[model samples]
Target: MSKVISRDGTIIEYDRTGDGPPIILVMGAFNDRSTGAPLAGQLEPDFTVINYDRRGKGESGDTLPYAIEREIEDLNALIAEVGGSAFVFGYSSGAVLALHAAVKGVPLSGLVLYDPPVEGYDGRLVHQLTELISAGRRGDAVEFFQSQLVGMPEQVVVQLRNAPFRPYLEAIAHTTVYDTKIVCEPPKQEELAGISVPVLVVAAEEMRDKFKQAAELLVSVLPKGQHLCLEGQSHHIVAPVLAPVVKKFLLS
Candidate 1:
């Protein structure tokens, strides 16, 4: 693991591996660098994969009074650390952050977004998540998020409580609200239309209306962009299946 200091003086920890064009992986809410590991390893042979804990998760340091721009600044710092411009791939809410960084004029050769949960979510949900975290109900927060944001059914969320990663979800429950702040207001189409870098937007064919709308916004608005829908893939994508398509797009 390595560390980079952000413009705001926050410490961001990351793992850098392989040897080629660089790709930084941004995970969704409740996910840290480990969530990015499988995709990172798959791309490492052709890209210098930098998998990092977004601020407030894993080994990354957090600065109070969180704002989305601060998170964008974190990625900006990591980009500079990796050396100027490079490709960036973000999953779910992290994909929203990647778009925010690009639209805000961060340096990037291209972008790959995998099913960013971009939506105009209700404030009540965010408020509830905040209350849960504030009351030290991290497990409930995790279940609430999976059922709401990830669209996992109630039964599945109940079954998920037994999964080994449930603790990891609890461990990062504090960041769930941070993620809500990111996705509650997605970049307007006008903002997306201004991105000059090439973008590859991928979503599953079976994705719900909102997800499809979000993915379409990315492709339809970006000046240079393409869309791909995996036949059987969903938001919870299979890395081996995802890596090849990403490689083709990034290398194109």
Candidate 2:
């Protein structure tokens, strides 16, 4: 494990592997660096992969009165550690965060986003999650995210009530507020248009239609954007199938 201090003095922990061009993995909610370990392992043979814990989770440090810019700064710190530029791969809501960072002019060589949830986040979700977490109902917060926000059925939520990962989800439930705030107010199309770097928005064949539609729309809006839908894939990462596509794009 390695660390870099962000602009606001927060220590961000990361694992670095391989020895070539740099690529940083930015994960979504319900994830720490561990969620990205498999993909990192696959990419490390050809690219130097940096997998890190976003603030407020894993071994990273967090600051109170969180602002979205702080998260951008966290990513900027990582890019700086990699010599001021790197390719970035963001999954789920982390993809949204990456787009926002690119808009704000963080140095990036290219971007790859997988199955970004470009729609369906509630405008009032930040307030609701804050209330639940502040009231010490972390379990409820987790369930609210699973059922209401992510649209999991109640039966599925109930079935996973005692899941071994339930506690892990609840442990970082507070950061769900961070992710909700990020996706709830997505980047403007005009802002997206201003990004001058190459971007690839990827979707899975078996995922919801909305995901494919969102990828196509994002591609249309981005000046250098392209879209690809993988066969027999879903929202989850299948690193063996994905790593080659990412490698091709980054190398191109």
Candidate 3:
């Protein structure tokens, strides 16, 4: 793992692999750098993949009073580290984060977003997530995010209580609040339209209506946006299926 210092002096940890144009991997909630490992492996042959632990999760350091701008600054530091401009690929809420960073003028050659869950959310979710995390209800916080944000069924959420990965989910529950703050509100059409960089919004064919709509909405507003739906895929991304499509769009 490599480390970089953000503008706020936070220690950001990331793994760099492969040897071509750089592509930073931004993960969604309940994830760390490890979440992108498979995709990195698949794309390593053609892209310099930087899979990083978002602040407050994995090996990355977090400063108190977290704000979205701090997260943006973290991306900026990584971008500067990788020759000042590169492709950025964001998954789920990470996609939303990438969009926020792009709108703020973080230099990027292009963007690739997969199933961004940016629709049908509101500020109340931010408040709810914050309260849960503040009260040390980490497990509940994790469950709430899975149930509400990820739209996991109630029965499925309960069934996962004994799942082996349950502990990992609770361990980084605090970061869910950060993600909620990043994506609670849907993107403004005017703001997204200003992002001049080419964008590829990848959606899953079997994904729910909200997700498909979210992908379509982004493509509709982005000045240079295009949409692609992966057949037989859902919110769960298969690296082999996705990496090739991503390579095609990014290289085009």
Candidate 4:
């Protein structure tokens, strides 16, 4: 494990592998660097892959009074550590954070996003989460988010809550609100108009309509962008199919 101090003095942890132009994998909620491992392994041969734990999870540090910009800074710090600029690939809400960073001008060579969970997150969800965490019902907080926010059926949530994953979900439950907070207020289309870097927005054909629409809408707003939908794929991209799409885009 390696570490880089962010602008706010928070230590961000990351693991690096492979060789070539740097690429950082930004993770979404309820996940740390581990979530990026599989995809990272696939990309390692063609690119140097750096997968890190986002603040407050895994081995990374967090600061008080978190701001979305702070997370953006965290990503920038990684970019700086990897020789100033590199390509980036974000998954789920991580894709949203990547765009936020790009709009703020993180030195990126190219950008690829895999089915960002763009729609459905709103201010009200943040409010509910804040209230839940404030009340100290962190477990219920996770349940509510999985069921209501992610649109999982209540029955499925109940089953999973009692399973082994519950502890992991609850362990990082507070960060759920943090994820909600960052993506809650999306940037106006005009804000993203200035992002001239090449971007590839991806969607899985079997994924939910909301995310598919989000991917399509996202591509529409970017000045230099393209779209691809993988056949026989779902929310969790099949790395074999996804990696090549990314490799082709960045290499071109």
The better candidate by lDDT, 2 or 3, is 2
Better of 1 and 2 by lDDT: 2
Alpha-carbon RMSD to native, per candidate: 1.5, 1.0, 1.0, 1.2
Residue 13's C-alpha lDDT in candidate 1? Answer: 98
Query: What is the per-residue lDDT of model 2 for residues 108-169, given as tens digits with 9 covering 90 to 100?
Result: 99999998887647689889999999999999999998887777889999999999998989
**What ranking of all candidate models by TM-score puts the best one first?**
2, 3, 4, 1
Give stretches of model 1 more than 4 Å off: 208-210
Candidate 1 structure quality by residue, lDDT tens digits, 21-76: 99999999888898899998899999999999999999999998788999989988
**Model 4, total clashes:** 0
Model 2 misplacement above 4 A: none
**Can you write out model 3's per-residue Cα lDDT over 1-252, one digit (the tens) per residue?**
899999999999999999999999999988898889999999999999999999999999999889999999999999999999989999998999999999899999999999898784877988998899889999999889989888889999999999999998898898998999888855688999999999999888888576887778778989999998888897877999999988998998
TM-score per model over all chains: 0.95, 0.98, 0.97, 0.96
Q: Would you give me the overall lDDT of model 2?
A: 0.92
Tell me the spans in candidate 3 whose CA falls farther than 4 Å from its real position. none
